[model samples]
Target: AEECINSKIHEIKTLEQVIGKLITRYNVLEENKLKSLVNIYEKMKPKDAARTLNELEMPTLLAVVKHMKDSRTAPIMAEMDSIKAKALTVELVTRNRLPFATAGSGEGDG
Candidate 1:
């Protein structure tokens, strides 16, 4: 009975570990999907791109803004309607000013 209980506990622990790993993997996969989508949108014309970016969730918008190069971002921001551009500019500036937040960190923080 003792051996059986121990074996069952070991199985449960293994299952828990597997579940944790799977959840982490899924989150990574979801992030990648969002990144790819943003990349596709970025490649579009500025007007179309701005519209697409506006449609995205705030978190996703932040991610896309973080990934964008300054040159590309400037042009995209310039092309967007004033209200949208202003909002995005604020986000970009805020993201730049803060060192700890944003997507990938270190070195080129923004």
Candidate 2:
């Protein structure tokens, strides 16, 4: 019985270590992908990027734009459809004001 308990504890510890590594890797990958998206948007022409960005999911579009500099994003926003631009602006504004909002921190969100 003692042997079994020791084995189980060891397994749990190993699993925890693996999970920690996986989380670190995932965070790195996400940061890299965001940087890539920012670069792509920055280099693309404003109107072209606006059209492409409008087709992205709102969450995705926001993620890309949120990392970008104001100088890079302004021209793109100018080229965007007014309604879409306004809606995104509102979300950005809200996010800035409530950076720690917990409105949807429950399970099943992912």
- lDDT for each residue of candidate 1 in 10-32, tens digit (9 for 90 to 100): 99999999999999999999889
TM per candidate comes to 0.64, 0.82
TM-score of model number 2: 0.82
lDDT by residue for model 2 over 1-110, one digit each (tens)? 99999999999999999999999999999999899989998999999999998888889989999999899899999999998999899988887764445566864654
Candidate 2 has its poorest 10 consecutive residues by lDDT at 98-107
- The C-alpha lDDT values of all candidates are 0.77, 0.90
**lDDT winner among the candidates?**
2
